[model samples]
Target chain A: MNRRALLGTAAAATFSGAMPGLVRAQAPGIKVGFVATLSGAGAALGTQLRDGWLLAVKHLDGKLGGLPAETLVIDDELKPDVAVTKVRAALERDKVNVVAGLVYSNILQAVFRPVTESGTFLISANAGPSTFAGRGCNPLFFTTSYQNDQVHATMGQVAQDEGYKRVFVMVPNYQAGKDAAAGFKSRFKGEVVDEIYVPLTQLDFSTELAKIAAAKPDAIFTFMPGALGVNLVRQYRQAGLASTPFLSSFTVDESTLPAQGEAALGFYTAANWAPDFPNEVSRRFVRDFEAAYGYVPGTYAAQAYDAAMLVDDGVKQAGGRLADKAALRAAMEKPGFTSVRGNFRMGANHYPVQDFYLCKVAKRPDGKLATETVRKVLSEDTDPYAAECRMR
Target chain B: MSLNLLLVQLLNGAQLGILLFLVAAGLTLVFGVMDFINLAHGVQYMLGAYVAATLGTLLGSFWLGLLLALPVSLLIGLLLEWVVFRHLYRRDHLAQVLATFGVILTVEDAVRAIWGSSPLAVPQPEGFAGGIEIMPGLTYPSFRLAIIAAGLLVALGLWLLVDRTRAGMLVRAGATNAPMVSALGVDIHKLFTLVFGIGAMLAGFAGALAGPVFAVAPGMGDGVLILAFVVIVIGGIGSIRGAFVAAILVGLIDTLGRAMLPDLLRLVMDASSARQTGAALASMLVYIVMAAILFLSPAGLFPVRRG
Candidate 1:
């Protein structure tokens, strides 16, 4: 064969490789980058968030709005640095139109600026720190979950209504933990006997439990998540603190209830949603989630499912044009999707303004543990930080 | 803190120390005798808890599960020693760290793949299920008391084995000088394997005991592993006596520091600021103690004398 013929054939092969890429760029599709702590102590929560989001995607037949969707799942490994690095890659390299799924506040804070500055929509499936909900609120950032303080504030209200004279507060030492303590204190009119701030990595709660016993408070309030929650609940029961009312948030939910078992039964937790919500959307979500994942869904999953719906509604309203940031932002502000929580709307700060429930751990007829909504604690509750938000 | 709270905190600290000692005893032995670093030592503790939880649930008896888990853990230790660890014995510390870290990732993923990411429920042994009255009003979990007792028993047994037995002497000699022991008509590799197996079993035992009280989930050992490392560093590597003393001391300091530091700081500062500052300081207490000890005695509190 001639040299020119050989060179022509090589050039044609290279052009053919480039042809599929050029054609795919013309197709109408949206890409989502889902980042969560999928491989450590917080893996269960991240797993729930991912599963719920995926289930919603599945229900929509792998399409968000009218466009086919491609999701790139990245495990943050529960590290802030890792989250920022991966999120930057998602924004710059993968060119994901939407960045979603962050279960921890620290991680969310780490990736928030990187994602929003890149002109990408950032949706938080779980973490909604007060930092983002207040004056630091961004037009590009929105959360399907409640503001960090909202649920804790619900518990504080319950304590006040119950007329607990003195309450002992315990929370992990971090931004969210501090927010939880503040939230609880903001509502409870009664005297706080003691406020214990344990390290986030602390799994054993013996010393804290002993202190609670010593203090002899009317009720004990704590906010421990993931493995920390599991250990605290079990130890609290074993230490015979069961007689003291255990009022908590994110401590005795569906994610930890399986391990907690009878130890967490009747424990009070405040949340915006539970697995046993009577709403049609929630009922369907819980039923399908259990059927698919072989475990009861938690609030994490519920919020993530709503996040997917919000994204779907926004995209649809924008007429599937992801590049139209202004239109997408406007559409997302008031997206018309029925939330699993029955009532969910974005407040001025882009955090959910919704009803919070005082839930109790209940055993299902099938012997699985789940949280049952006992009563509505807060109605149409907007975060306190929302008032400080400059965004209209 | 009141006298009652102090007593309870002391016991809690001891219980934590016992658990830490179980994990550290093996770690120190492995490090001292083999001159090898096993970052996956924490994985054994995790596995022990997993095995106990799964077996206990299946067998319908916590005691039986624990009894069986020890052998299974020992076997796992032996298996790992045979497969991954033996190959890396001659490698540098950095290589061992990298390789063992890989093992941790692999085992954690495998656990997640098999059991899912959720924490598993491990039932407490029936007799030790409830809290026992330590004082008139304050009560402590009996299961935790049992752990303390079991740990003391193990410590006594380890003391006997190390101080009085022929195999113990070899282990000590190996820790002091592996090459000299190997040249002096003794099978040093065999001694190293035995120490490794025992260390794995001890970690597993700690895990099984912890399973009932703590969350039995993937990466549960990672936090404890760091504490265990601190225990060995403070206790002196290869010294079981040092480990026991240092473990208890470390535990008491951690527990009491966390419980009282905020109140102490409250005397000087506002309550909220004190609580925040105290918590931050408490988390650093262990390392601070380690640093102080290391500064005072560069070889650690109970340094093994080198030949």
Candidate 2:
């Protein structure tokens, strides 16, 4: 009797699975494989991105472009090999129509080929590596986030405009870090006193901080992200180096400011958007995000919300015809939805041509720490690498 | 490097070494007395920081939080030994390693579930909030200096306890021959539990102290664990004195290498490539030194004397 009951259930399950495909053909639902670093030290950024994307979907009544949307959130664990393997599974096993969300550039570099080779619509919420922005640009790839180099370049321009003759630069020794150094140097034609590259896992910066004090440069520019930034900012102040102008990108942002506390106050960073962006979309996002997640939305969250909206608009424009790659690509290129960053458009390379802002860390009225926009630094700034991108 | 820079770097390295010593002391003792490869040892350090940060904020006093965390850490260690580690004591070394590694994963996940993955802030104590001029044109954080001094005090207290007490004698005997000590009618199991608890407390202490200076986040202990392992291996496994000397040596080498290698390489190569290669090489210096020391002395620099 038990065997007979099991057989009956199995037959019912097989029939129910077939029912989804039959229904899917009538109302073309979308499946998104959201891969991000949801665990380990970098998990904070990944969590923010994931939450932001989910919040956008929730705002759309749990559907993208009037179709039922199903998202499979996968934790990359910040490991390259793991990202490649899981992304492959998401593409092949799950047959996800769109792949979105990655926090680290290294992970993006690892999964880019497998994703693009399969001809899937890859929407990068963050980690816009310079390699893809330039000659390696693919029509299949699109980034809601600005190119990595472009944000770092803003700080470089700031340093130069402020008449800083000598600058001490520090970044993690990785592809993104190298790009940051190159980007900064492209704009600032000054003597770079020293460029210290620390390991990604390094939490202590006492030795490097010592070197900075000895050099006594006009300013210090760094690109340490996540916990690295947290430790560096606090230690910099503790070591009495706060007197030196702390110029950075992604180092003194909303995600890290909570841990950095008063140490990050008055420190400057450059980004495309902040929590205090003065617009209806951004204001609504910050208010809803804080109400939902109990934390201020950072740039990671803002960019990811844009990525989801882009996908939603793309699907809407394509009339839910996901299989038509060209139509979907064109729809995504000119995203119809209002961006949180008011003036945002896709560049020739599929990266954002957006205004950049110089932001300062400030304590909010409710005593929460967040980044506030100081002023606009670049208006409709396209990445330098776009000229090299010959997108087919 | 200039004289001022060198002096500050030295202090930084010494502070790092002191923290490594505190963590390694417990690790070495557990390994030596029990012959158990406790890969989960690092999680104790992480737990220490987490408990301190949470309680410190709650009670509004870093000192009170630190004081309360020690007993809590001790209780957690004892509970872990009773629940999980006791069963694994009779297991083989590979089994112990695999099991303890499982513990590390379980604890890391639990931490994330409870505290979330973001780093927690542990404010510096009131008195040690700023830097003091250690040398002309060079200032160091007083909190770091306090850490170094506290570590030294702990080291001295540990020495007195281990070298000048009856419990210390039993621990030495157990390290030499656990079976013989058992045969001599000592409660070997109790000794094992005691050593394990103490080791956990020491590691927890280090973590709590590190909270104000370093990042208090999940998996924060993993990197320190690797360095502590290196310290024990290079110091001669199971020797506190050896762990101390080796920890300081490793710390100085790592700190100085990172600070000086790039500048040194610039003399022979272009500045950009030199910085790149130097950063790569500096990270490798610790492991390279470990290999060299292991080659020179297979049992490490100061192998515990066996009867």
Per-prediction DockQ comes to: 0.46, 0.47
TM-score of chain B of 2: 0.97
lDDT of 1 by residue, B214-259 (tens): 8998889999999988998898887888899989988999998998
lDDT of 2 by residue, A1-392 (tens): 23322332233223222111111222357888888776676777887888789889888977887788888777787889888998999899989899999998889989999999999989999988888999999999999998878888999899888999999999999877898888888889998999999999886798998888888899999998878888898888888888899999989887788788888898999999999988999999999888877778899999999999999999999998889999999998888999999999999999999999889998999999899998998899999889999999
Off by over 4 Å in 1: A1-26, A80-95, A318-327, B88-95
TM-scores, all models, native as reference: 0.91, 0.92
Candidate with maximal TM-score:
2
Residue B55 deviation, candidate 1, in Å? 1.8
Check candidate 2 and list the clashing pairs.
Answer: none
Off by over 4 Å in 2: A1-28, A80-95, A110-119, B135-138
Local error of candidate 1 at residue A273 (angstroms): 0.9
